[model samples]
Target: MATLNGSPVGLADMQALALTNYGHFTTMVVEDGAVRGLALHLDRLVGDCRTVFGAELDPEWVRECVRREVSGCAGRRTVRVTVFCPGLDLTAPDLEARPCVLVTTRPTGGVAGPLRVQRRTYHRDAPTVKHVALYGQIRLRRAARLAGFDDVLFAGADGLVSEGCTWNIGFVDAAGSVVWPEADVLPGVTMRLLRSAHGRHVTAPVTDGLLRSMRAAFATNTAIGVQSVAAVDDVVFRTDDPVVTALREAYAGVPLERL
Candidate 1:
């Protein structure tokens, strides 16, 4: 079942959200009532609400809402929290614009296999906030899927790779140092957690030539912690690389917090 601010979401609310897609959201998997980087998720919600709605959202209220939704869940569960304004960004004569929180849950399983991503030249508008408007990116990914690729990795007009449709991409050089693309991309929560565990990493222009030359590559997101990339448009990578293995282990070692 889906919920909104500790209450059930109905057809009217869903219909309203479809009109004005001006909101920020975050999604993460909660396992056995524990979450990784819980504080960071809360911070993202509060900060993004302030930026998008010109108002402050209480982190405690968010947690309480989430707790009420998933209070009795037994296994891995997915939670999506969104903050949006009512009345389609315009308040009525007696109404004022206030950000509303929406929470929903579903059962989640393990991560998928290594992804085979196709390169697409695309860029996100804001790149930082996890907003609601994403049909453009989703459309690109759908087209890539229809063509046999597992997902799409966005590139810039300058030929620099940024990130994936729903994840952050990373590469390892011959020396075994993790290299992230130095471009505008969403900084995923799992990406941040992995970076903290990975001692040190570098960022550079991830050009197509660089993608072809990298020793190994992987994708990171809340849905998939650190998944090896089998190929990036015919340029193959070693899924069993030692760097990828170590990262997977480090990510598994990250402690979880009660949700």
Candidate 2:
């Protein structure tokens, strides 16, 4: 029961669909009609889908479907494709393979700058999946904008930092160690890759001093590969710090795969 570009898509239209109890979406950058990081994005999409849905999915099929769809696109463009569940019980076999909605090839707004951050208390269910249930994030963004900030950082009732409304939060210590909150935050794809390659440590309940020395801070999501953090609550850091530069380069060098 998925619709692509307002048209109903048949089962034969795709090789596979990743379903989850919570909604999910994906963003891709396309140039010359070719999608970048198709394999990596699909791998993550399938993996998250399986984890949230509590079932296994075919990786090869997902890859082929994305390939088929993107290959049909016509010209240089930046595309974002999103798939969401229609609030049905994901445990059902039929619903497991059918996404409620599918959107593709929309324009990316613009490159965001150093975000002005406002702290708030908000939590989400199934934080790992890229779901469409983003009311909290939407509200937080509007609040941030009205408050003259670019984004919002959520904290738990325990006075510990959770994450940004739309991105993972990272901090650097005076000792040059890159730190992030523990598993409470979404296991961001960029964070996972960076942690795997760099072996950085994840700390619990981020702090102010630690956030300040952030020598370099950035956020990673599907659309923006790695965006630098310029200022947080009027506190600014050197955007070109070696640690930040190295991470940006390392992330760029890792070849994207479809697995």
Candidate 3:
């Protein structure tokens, strides 16, 4: 049985509920009782909720709810907190702030190795907001896994690379230039920090060939701070490459709690 808005809700029940309710949702995964980038995630949730739902939420109430839910976790584990806008009938929308749904300590498989990525053509606006409507991403991930690639990288209709199915993408070129997708991709919290601290060292929309030299690349998400990419189709990136090593070390130097 799953949970929705603090009430017991089975997966089937939630799916049925969502079919009738048209709104947004945010999911944050916390590990070891520590939620990486919790503040940023909450801010995004609130901002997105207001944008999509057109009503402000009580941050203190939401924070208290999250605290209560997280306190239920056991050891070093993963917990998912979901804030959903259940009903949005413009004619008569529900303006209340519903309880956040908390699912305690669920297994997320083991830590994954560096990913092999395949490029596709798709782009999303407002990538930072976590929404419940993710069928397109879900389908792409399934197709990628079946093709033996760990994940899929999407390019905008204009041919600019956006991001991976679930994370932000960053690359390193032969000349050791660190390149990242422009703002068209999700502004990941980890990516934001790396950019702010090392802005002068990074490049955006780097030359096309740079993708080939890609001495190193990584994807960032809330669950994983910075994960190296093993390959892009047949092209391989060395984890020990000097540039890759330096970036990894820099990322490690940042307090994990800060992220």
Candidate 4:
């Protein structure tokens, strides 16, 4: 279920990640021999490697590593690829790093529905990169869940809705256009895939005030696909909204690529 550079991952190989926690990763869902948005996922890994490690990563090698981990898997599975330098010294930081690729897989769970989230005013460090530092997001998620919410929705200091703990959020305007919030959030692969399939959509600022005029909202990611947002704080949206249904259908219709 876990491999480091196509071989079994060892505890010693995880030292740097455990101590320094400096790395980037991507989570994807692979089914049988095919993956949705496989190219985008690899592109993200390659780009994040440059940003985080100041080094180039071979996307094809990463692809083969993923394929090695998920080959002959029955049904659906969640695969995570993490890139980090195991030999990095904190005192004498090396700019030129040879990062290691760690691929792990687990059985996929049933997609949850109608997320009820609490909005918090926070933003991630290097929000654009999918890095391994997740203490802040996990803390907020735990607090939200303890307070009777399913998850957390992060907003900027100006009260603009940005993203979820691990996914991107989109809104359906009164005119039935998909409104993606323009904020410092990770450009999600699922969001891009949905945008191409959903014809009428726009990128705009989604504020707490704007949510009142919105017709409905949904969360997008590889795991849940298009999941309706039932409530944000006290505001509630209908889970069966037609626009949300259309988005789900569009995402489902997207062709899966072979790995």
Q: How close is candidate 2 to the true structure, as a TM-score?
A: 0.75
Q: What is the C-alpha lDDT of each candidate?
A: 0.87, 0.63, 0.64, 0.91
List candidate 2 stretches off by more than 4 Å.
Answer: 1-22, 30-40, 51-56, 72-103, 108-110, 198-204
Candidate 4 per-residue C-alpha lDDT over 144-249 given as tens digits, one digit per residue, 9 for 90 to 100? 9999999999999999999999999999988888899989999999999998887698998887788878889999999899999999999998889898998899
List candidate 1 segments past 4 Å from native: 89-96
Assess the local accuracy of residue 47 in candidate 1 as a C-alpha lDDT between 0 and 100: 86
Weakest 10 consecutive residues, lDDT, candidate 1? 88-97
Off by over 4 Å in 4: none
Residue 87, candidate 2: C-alpha displacement in angstroms: 8.5
Q: Whole-model lDDT, candidate 3?
A: 0.64
User: TM-score for each prediction?
Assistant: 0.95, 0.75, 0.80, 0.97
- Give the candidates in order of TM-score, highest first: 4, 1, 3, 2
**Could you tell me which residue pairs clash in candidate 4?**
none
Q: Give the TM-score of candidate 4.
A: 0.97
Per-residue lDDT tens digits for candidate 2, residues 1-259, read 2345346566544433433325466666655544545666667667766665555545555444455456655554444445544434435545544443354555556667655577787876777677667778889879987998888887777656678888887766566677787647776667767776664666755666556555666666656656777777767866666776677677677664432
Error of 4 at 19 (Å): 1.6
lDDT string, candidate 3, 1-259, tens digits: 2455445656664553466444454445555555545676667667866765666766556555555555656544444555554443345455564434434435544547788998777766456666656778878888988998998988776666778988888887777777887646656766766665552456466334657767788887656657889887777888666665665566545543411
